[model samples]
Target: MSDKKLLLLSSSREGQTDYLEHALPLIDGFLDKSIKNVLFIPYAGFAMGYDKYEDKVNQPFQTIGKKVTSIHRFDDPVKAVEEADAIAIGGGNTFHLLKELYDNELIDAIRKRVDQGMPYMGWSAGSNVAGLTICTTNDMPIVEPRSFNALALVNFQINPHYTDYQPPNHNGETRAERIFEYVRANPHRYVVGTREGTALQLKDNKLTLVGNKPGLVFRDGEKTRPIQCNTDISWLL
Candidate 1:
């Protein structure tokens, strides 16, 4: 895992901020200066055409002196991944994203690259694929993938855009309850519930939570706990 570098964000925007604005600084810090071009995976943005998605992302990336070329633009996506200096995945529907990845046979190609020291960044559904499996994702199964398994860049599961708030007079499971259910079913695994603005950073064998709010962790037979920002959580890795 020493060669792995991952920045998994809970969401693209945080409370009225511009798209990716809150994450720009963290992205800059995570990426190496040598990385000028980033390969983007826009499969999750199925509602918005890939061309539009790429344009939306490039706007922010250009500000940091980096450029993103969407994988959809390439004839051979696996080859694109192999040749990419870095990779960034955008958020939308996790199921759609996974299905597209499997259809294009890019899961293994991307995993191999990231395992060999390529930088990876993702947000929301994008972040969901970085976990052990997509079972913990908040997204609806609008489409089915060949498998629930994901990148496994980290050892645990991720629940992005996590919130415990129960709206007035609404009868439904809270976010914590859903995560609790997942832990009960998968007793051995850990689930990290990242708030809207938070992110999990893994580099140099160290894992840290970034942002002002604390993240939540849930596991079977263990008390749920808060993960403070800017603290070491490599143990979870």
Candidate 2:
């Protein structure tokens, strides 16, 4: 746990902000200056090809004076992870991403690398996979992975892109109700509902919620609580 460095974002864009524009500052600050290149995992990007995904991410990374290389470009993806200075996983479909990771056998490789103090950052579905399991993700199960278990980068579950808003005449289950159902079945676990534009940063044995909006914390038999921005949530660790 002491060796882990993570930046888990709720979403890639905030309302009308440009792609990766809202997160550039946090991304730049979270990554060490010594990291010249970031290994990118674009498995979640099902609509666009990996090459296009790489190009999309590079657009903003170049602004920060860093380069991004997608793992799909490498002959040996596992070796790529082992040798990367840092890694970033982009958002798309969670199930597809997890399946590809399992199929390529990069799960253990990535977990091992991050455990060795390599910086890891992700957004949306990418952030969903950073938790103990992908059960809390909002994406529908379009594909199945080897298992729902994920990287376990963080001990608890994460509900990224969280929103409590229920539109008029919309009778669908609210996000809170959905999360309540999850905690009811998995009582001991904690789920952090990271709102749009928010991120969770873990460094120096402390976890800080980043953003202007407040996040939510959920557990069985307990009232949901709001986690203020810049608050230390290392207790979840």
Candidate 3:
């Protein structure tokens, strides 16, 4: 129950960046000796498309030195998460991910598995599930989420790819700023910005960084600041 490892990749892991290419390889590293079976939980991309987010989520295991058996579930969901050595969730829409997790009764299964030391990896919307509340997610709720309580596996809310780059047609503040604003008002929460090509690695109760970039932690109304990464995580060490 204590050897679990989690690699929560920010949204852009599917993006075409040079260092982002290391995404899958880093995932493979988690599966090297500890992981034997893999469960591909494509709940986030539920209604979107079976494209990059979902395929990329599973493709890493199919090609690597490790031969992982994948299970994609829209049904018989409970059995899927319960039978795996590891669980990988892909990115797309955060609401959709929450819906599927609730509808399929996979939330309890996932939380239980993760608590039991199953290696769990998620990207983007998938990664959003790392925090206690799904409110920090930047994705517009195309559909109402089934639940607002995230897995609460970590102590902070994760705003993956926290960019100040605001695109036009957006209503108010940019997604990043909106998240910051929301958390600012709600001072009880802690949020971390997992930038592109970077990941928050939680293993054996240790949280560390992987890929090329480091994550930024934001609190209060202050701007996000980068912390030194790539070292033993004092948090769980």
Please, what's the RMSD in Å of model 3?
3.2
The parts of candidate 2 lying over 4 Å away from their true place are none
For every candidate, C-alpha RMSD to the true structure in Å: 0.8, 0.8, 3.2
Task: Quantify all predictions' global Cα lDDT against the true fold.
Answer: 0.95, 0.95, 0.71
- How many clashes in each candidate? 0, 0, 0
Error of 3 at 1 (Å): 8.3
Point out where model 1 deviates above 4 Å. none
Deviation from native of the Cα of residue 187 in model 3, angstroms: 0.9
lDDT score of model 1?
0.95
Error of 3 at 86 (Å): 0.5
Give all TM-scores, in the order shown. 0.98, 0.98, 0.84
- lDDT tens digits, residue span 62-173, model 3: 5654443335533566887777777877777888888767776778888888888888888788789877878888888887767798887777788887666766786777
